[model samples]
Target chain A: MHLLEIQNLTKIYEGKKVLDDIDLHLKKGTTLGLIGPTGCGKTTLLRIIDLLDLPSSGKIFFDGIDITASNVKDMDIRRRIGMVFQKPIVFKGTVYDNIRYGLKVRGKNEDSYETEIFKLLDSLGLAGYEERDASTLSGGETQRIALARVLITEPDLLLLDEPTANLDPLSTEKIEKLIAELSKKKHTTIIMATHNLIQGQKLSDQIAILNKKIFQMGTPEEVFLKPAHKFVAEFVGVRNVKKGTATQLEPDLTLIKLRKINIYSISHLEGLVYASIRPEDITLSKMKVISSALNEFKGNVKGIVDNGGLIEIEVDVGEDFTVHMTRKSFLDMELTVGSEVWLQFKASAVNVFECEC
Target chain B: MSEIINAFFQAINLIVSLDPEVIEITLRTMFISLSSTFFAALIAIPLASLIHFNKFRGKRSVMNVIQTLYSLPTVLVGLLVFLLISKSGPLGNLSLLFTPGGMILGQTILVIPTVIGFSIIGLRGVKEEIKELALSLGASNLQTVTTIMGEAKYALLGAIILGFGRAISEVGVALMIGGNIRGYTRVITTTMSLETQKGNVELSIALGIILLSIALIVNLILNQVQER
Candidate 1:
């Protein structure tokens, strides 16, 4: 069953539309990753879902009940949802008092909850720091405390907005692991906004790429393998793309034409097209080699960019094309700034998209 | 030179001896000033918070009125309160003309605007992101306000101290409204004025020393509290 649903959500500020006709749905116990560029309404969407901002016009249903226009008194819906902001805000008090703020506001002062609070703190690596001043904590420590503060409430849905944007790599890894473990243990539904695509792929069960609109939404594997729009394909780091008109020849084979170049694809697409190939799918050879691959282009290495473990080699095959290969391959081929090479890839590796021109 | 030395030694002797009349006047001064400052803070802090946090029509006009009131002369406030409490005035039936309550009323009117103006400046200086974070945590409007107050507690305390210091040292309002009645409303400043007019340097110097000591103690306590 759908746990939350938003329909036709629109928000306008100062005669400009910030959010335009956004629709989304979430299922129970699933993590949804919201991926977008900066200023792409991701945080605004989270704010609307948390009921911090009223939509210009929309219907929001949580637990099969419409909660639009509800006031703070009618906040049973809010009780079931908790949000962690991008920057951790620790009140001016001891860490224990900061965590106890929400509970105290709700008129709960039982000492029995302290045990659970301690356990949560321990799990988030904040043990023995309850009585410490909140202002003395580091950025990562504060983020953990913020998460621990919300998780102790045991809300059914947890919303985190860029929770690890400011953390070091080790802290980021720890937080990602803690999130995964919490989901498995409590069946908690999580909605997180992230600019890190690799982290999104590792942590989220479902991914939604939001541009000016909902560019695509599906399971991480489904969205990564079959992006419905060119924006989503590029956002997920699928780099080698050629804009063309696509004709479906069969269930597996298609034809794409760009200017004077006609390319055949074993993937089917119809109408105006974007033929995308993951950079890793193409192989670079220093010399001509025989291969069963149907598409092989002789090109010159226009540029080589070293990005951590992989080398991104831009090949000019009578047209601009990008090919990503391992650092080992570049070193073995002795590829340099002006190296000549043959780029080979199977037709089946091309992802075809049919959308408006 | 001998008379000046006599006055100074006798002033110290009066304080050490805790002379009844001098003690009574000093105690009355402390009571009136502290009570008025406390009452002003109680009314001003929440009013300032409201004005700082919410948007409303006529807000600029309201702020302008507050800013104008903030610099209102102590003598002017004394005259205004004096008219209201005088026998032929609007509140004549209450008979508060020469009482400590009348002095307190005048001082409260004088100090309230100072407290409110500084409190508004303090609360307004807190970052907007902190408020948004509290709101996103599903805190109600009251909770948000409380959080902001907690965050700005140091600034608010400083404002209260400033108002208290101003109220305690203000002699114009206290002298005008209380009328310096002996054993009833004769406070430190009024007594000092009367003693000096009669050329009695010992009692006048004693009262002056008490007032300066009280002001110094208040300032020291404020500094210590702020340091913490």
Candidate 2:
């Protein structure tokens, strides 16, 4: 049975619809990642699920009971769920007190969780920090403590809003590891909202691309590699999105025509469509090489940006195409502004998705 | 100038010697001011939290009026209280006129607005995220408020201390209501006013030094809490 279900949830703030007609379901002990751009109602959806804010319409069923009524006073319902905000909240006290707050509110004595608290502190790399003031800790340490505070209660559902958005790389890795462990060992269901695509793929069993509503929902591989819609393709870092009309060129190949560029894909999508290719998929070479790849064009490098170890080149071959390559490749080819290059990719590399207006 | 300098040394002597009259006046001043601040806090903190955490019609206008009353003159509050407790007034039958109780009543009225104003600011100053964090952690409604009050305890304490400072430093309310009775209702501010008027600069200076010391202590504590 699904542990939680949200049906037709809509939230209107000041008569402006923020979340419109959204539906979702989560099985027990599974992680659902909510991914979207900023101001895309991801936080609002999490707030409603955690019961911190009520939805303007629709029902949320938790454990087979509808709990979306505004006057629901069951503390037990809230007690079974934990939510961590985007900004870490550290009350005026020592680390021990902040971690013990959840238990304290439930009328549990400090002695009851002393051993467990110490174990969590040690595991979170906060040993000997029980006496340290929470306010004096670094941002990463504070976020860790906030997570510890919520997790110590053994909540059934955990809601995290960008828990590692601003942390150092080490802290982010530690938090991600802890989240995976929680779901595996404690059987805690989690819904994490993040804008980082790689992090969402790494931490979530199911990914929901949300923008005012769920645009697409599937496994990480399905959502990232085979986006079902143009919005998802664009949002998932597919840099080259071309509006074109597709014509069946063969039994297995379809030709997509842009204003001045022609591309071929293995998918037999017809009519008006969008063909998307990730930047790293398009290989740039100084010479046009004979290959089995169906799409190849000689283009001029219009712009070049050194993105740390990688080079991002915008080539104009009847159309603008952004391509990413390693610094070694760019230096070997001596690629720079106005450099002539050949762009080549396989027909399978292009994903044809219809635009959802 | 020399007289003033001499009075400064005399004021130290008075404080060190613990003169009975000075001690009595100081104790009465603390008693009245402490009572007024206590009563004001008893009413103001919860009221401020309620007004701050809830939404209602006219809430902005109500807060504006309260903020305006934060600076209402002590003498004006004293005058308003005096009329209510005077003979032929509606509350005259209580026999609180010309007594410390009357002075406390007037000071409480004067300090309540300030306490509320500061409490609202202190509570509002806490990030909105904290409250949501508390509720998300399974805190009951009362527990959420207790958590907020704990987070803002220093600011709340600062508000009470500020109210005490304002009450103990004002003379108009104490003079008009307490009648400045020598052994009955005389407090520091009223007695200081009387001594200064009588040209007994030494006693007035002693009282002034004690008052300023109290104000300094309160503000020092307030500043310390604010820094944290």
Candidate 3:
């Protein structure tokens, strides 16, 4: 059975629907990365699942028990689930007291958890800092302390709402590594809402794209490689989107017409259509390659951008198309502005969707 | 100016000499004000916490009413308490009129609104994030209240001190309710009024000095608490 299931959850705030019919399920010991733009109801979803607020409709089940029921003791459910808010909230006391507050309130003997608490502190690079004042700590230190406070309780399910949103790079790395280790070693279920797409892709075992609703839900590969919606395509950084008209070329083949160009894709989408392809899929070559790939166009390398480990080359066949490749590939091809190149990708690489507007 | 200086000197001499009447009045004043402040705090802290943390219909209007009552005239409060404890009044059986108890009661009523008003502001001053953080950590409603109260400790203390300051310095309630009975119900404010009326400016100036000193101390502490 799924450890957590949100069935048709809807949340309306002040007569405005912030979350509309969001349905999701997560197995035990897995991290579900919730990625969305701001005001997309990521925090609201987490708040409802954490039992901080009641849903307008639908039910949330935890371990097959309906936790959203009015009769369920919320304290019992809340004790088993921990949440880290976006802003770090350290109680008014020493770091030691802040970290121990959760365990203390849950009726755990503080003395017995001394070693465990210290171990958590050390793991988070907070050793020897227990006696320091929590309020006096820096932002990164405060967030680390907040996480330690929640983690010490050993909650069954941990909910993080952009836990590392405002941390320094070192702190972000530390928190990400800590989360990874915790999930792997302790098998703690985690649901993290984050705007950092790269961090979401890196940390989450399963990804759910929430934008007033569940736009997409799948593995990182599936969501990034084959987005089912235009919002997901744009959010996932697939930038080569073009509006075109698709017609049946033959059995199991669809042809889309663009201004001054025609591209073949494998889709049943007809009439007005929108097609997107990831920048990485298109290969840029200095010479024409003889291949069975049906979508090949000769264009100039209009712009060459050095993006750290990789290079983004904008090739303009009829319209500007971005192609990503390693810096080594760019150097090997001797690519520069106005350099003639052939952009090639298989027909299956184009993801066509029915245009809604 | 000379007369005023002479009165100031005479007042200081009276205080320095530890006159039994002045000592009794000062102590009684402290007792009455402190008791009123204590009772006010006992009622105000929890009431303000409720208003601060919970949302209910008419909450804003209730808060506005409390705020308006902060400026309630002490004479009006004194009249209200006097009528309640008068011989033909509802609480007449208590026989608290013209005594220290009556003064304390009137002072308590006089300070309660300010106490509650300032306390609500102080408690509300606690960051919303702090309260939410505590609740999200699985804390019970009571535990969260404790945490919030703990966070607003300084401001709440300031509120108490402010109420005590207001109670100790005001004369209308104590005059009307305590009747300023010498050696029994007399306090700093009432004593100052009586001495000044009797043309004894020296004693009046001495009591004024003491009252001003108390106000100064309260304000200093208030500034320090707020700054903290």
TM-score of each: 0.92, 0.83, 0.89
With candidate 2 superimposed using the best TM-score fit, by how many Å does residue A1's alpha carbon deviate from the native?
A: 1.4
Local error of candidate 3 at A11, Å? 2.6
* Candidate 1: regions farther than 4 A off: A70-76, A284-292, A299-308, A326-342, B226-228
Per-model RMSD to reference = 2.6, 4.4, 3.1
Give me candidate 1's TM-score against the actual structure: 0.92
Quote the positional error of residue A196 for candidate 2 in Å.
Answer: 1.5
B1-228, model 3: which lDDT tens digit per residue? 999999999899989999787788888899999999999899888888888888899999998999898888999999999999999999999999998898888888888878888888888788888877887788888888898899889889988998999899998999999998888898998888888889999999988888888889889989999887
TM-score of 2: 0.83
Docking class of 2: medium
User: What TM-score does each prediction get for chain A alone?
Assistant: 0.93, 0.91, 0.92
lDDT tens string, model 1, B1-228? 999999999999999999998888888888998899999999999899989988999988988999898788888988999999999999988999889999999999999988999899888878887776666555777888998898888879988988888887887898899988899888888788888999998999998888888889878877886665
The CA lDDT at B16 in model 1 is 96
Cα shift from native, residue B99, model 1 (Å): 1.7
- Candidate 3, residues A87-168, lDDT tens digits: the string is 8878888999999988877878899999988998898998999999888999999989999999998888999999899789
Query: Candidate 2, residues A1-357: lDDT per residue as tens digits?
Result: 899999999999989899999999999999999999999999999888888778999999998878886566657788988988898879889999999999999988879789999999888888899999999999999999999999999888899999999999988988999999998888899999999999999989999999998999999999998888878887987778888999998999999999998999998888898888888899999999999998999999999998797889999999999999988888899987999999999999998887654
Q: Give the CA lDDT, 0 to 100, for residue B49 in model 1.
A: 90
Preferred candidate (DockQ higher): 2 or 3: 2
Candidate 3 residue-wise lDDT at A283? 85
Interface RMSD of 1: 2.0
